[model samples]
Target: MRTVGLALVLASLMAGNAMAQPKWAIVVHGGAGVIARAHLTPEQEAAYRAAMTRVIQAGGEVLAGGGSALDAIETAIGLLEDDPLFNSGRGAVFTAEGRNELDASIMDGATLKAGAVAGVTRTRHPISLARAVMEKSPHVMLMGAGADTFSHETGLEQVEPAYFYTERRWRSLEQFLTQNNLPIPARPEGAAAPDAAAGLAHDEGKYGTVGVVALDQAGHVAAGTSTGGTTGKRWGRVGDSPIIGAGNYASDASCAVSATGTGEYFIRLTVAREVCALVEHRGLSLQAAADEVIQQKLTALGGDGGVIAVAPDGQMAWSYNTSGMYRARLADGEPLSVGIYKDEP
Candidate 1:
């Protein structure tokens, strides 16, 4: 009898240990948009797929090998930001006035603490500044010049305005302005606007790009998003990126969400938080809630785009109304991806 009891106890302990084994996961996006078959060349599609593959692999390896969730999120986003194809860090889009204004936010779901920076120029890593704000500052968000000041106080590297200039972004801006027939602004001082023949400003109505979500690791969750603010935006437009539970929201009790698409519709719906709340309070599955919000609510509100989410039980979902979204997910140890564009898929 004594031997049997000891054996039973040992079996229970081993089972517990097996269940307690740590698991790691991550999801990412390039940018969501009306990605039509006609728009992508074979080369561009291949490039996006390759880029997403590299970044997701980098982040997944870190998580699979016992990395922190924070590290995973930052590492994944950093890669996307560096890629000019996405609209975040280095490859961010151009504003109406033809300048780069970036916004980013990060949240730890376990602690419910967050940091964000808006309209930051000259900061090498806006997400790092956001982390600094969450960890070091009294505020949840800092914007414009104040954000710059905070970056300086924290010893973050600052760059000249020219550092962000790239032919692609300039060309995109010019194409957008020309397509919309918006009045062209006088060149800054002696500078001349890029030639109109370059298809500049062709896609101006399509500008909002952000990403966020949580991972399935035990007792951990996080949400983050980054973007180049709306193109041709006037009056210092600030979107939901820096707003808690708007552009990004996370909770260990429910899920984490990152939104992309039209910023106004996201703000109108309180899109990120609403999804989490529906799951937490209304008992909706992560997929159902996301569908309702992205498909139903935002659509009814006259907005288009999508969101990425992860529930506590490791359930993952991507919901969108656009032609394509730049997204990838690792679930149950399988690499799954969803995208409209050929390269990102």
Candidate 2:
């Protein structure tokens, strides 16, 4: 009788240990817009896919190693900010005045603390600055020259405005101004002449922003977003990227969300928070909640954009209204998956 009782106790303990195992996952997006398969050459698609693959692996390593969701998301988003393929830091699109003005935000789900920066021109990685704002400053957001000054004081990397120049984005800026019949701003100081080989891929209304939502082994979730705002924006135009609850939100009780799309529409709808609200308030699954806000609500409002999300349970999802969205996801002990077009499974 004594032996039987001891065996039962051991069995119960083993079951509890198994249930306590952590589940981690991460999802990312480069942008969403009118990216039709017919428009992207095979080479272009491959380039984008390779970039997303690299980002997912780098971020996934952090979660797999038991890092906090906040660290994992910051690592992932900082890489995207460095990569020119997406519009966050380097290779960012230019304003109407031909200057690069960047925006970024980060949210920690475990504590609900958030940080953001807007119109930062000299900071090399705006995402890091955003995190600094959350960790170092008393404010939720800092913008324009004050944000730049804070960045300088924080000792974040700074660069000459010319460092952001790239032939691809410059050509897009030129083409955009030409089509809209706006006066062309002179080439920025220290920027090189535009290359004739640069491709023409300009769509200010549709594509451009980089974001990440990560759920770590500790069951914490976090979200981040970064962008150069819309092309040819004038008079200090800021976008949803740096706006908490608009382009980025995170909550361990529900989910973490990062969005990319037209700034005005996202701001109008509070897209990121809306997705999380559906899950917390309406008892929707991660996928269903994302679809409900992006596919139905945003679409009905005539907005075009997309969102990537991860819940504390490690459920991951992405939804978009555009023809394509540059996205990728990875779950604990699962293969990395990437999707670009609307038709992908």
What TM-score, computed on C-alpha atoms, does each candidate reach?
A: 0.85, 0.91
lDDT string for model 2 (1-345, tens) is: 999999999999998766654488999999998888888777778878888899988999998898888888888888888777777787788998899999999999999999999999999989999999999999999999999999999999999998888777877889889999998888889888453224433242424999999998888999999998888889998889899999999999899999999888999999999999999999999999999999899999999999999988778899999988999999786789998899996
lDDT, candidate 2, at 148: 96
The list of candidate 1 runs beyond 4 A from truth reads 1-22, 179-205, 336-338, 341-345
What lDDT does each candidate get? 0.74, 0.88
Give the number of the best model, judged by TM-score.
2
Query: Judged by lDDT, which candidate is best?
Result: 2
- Residue 132's lDDT in candidate 1: 87
Question: Candidate 2 at residue 163, lDDT?
Answer: 82
Clashes of 1: 14
For candidate 1, lDDT tens digit of each residue in 215-313?
645548788888876665666788877777878888888888888888877888899999999999999999999999999999998988788887766
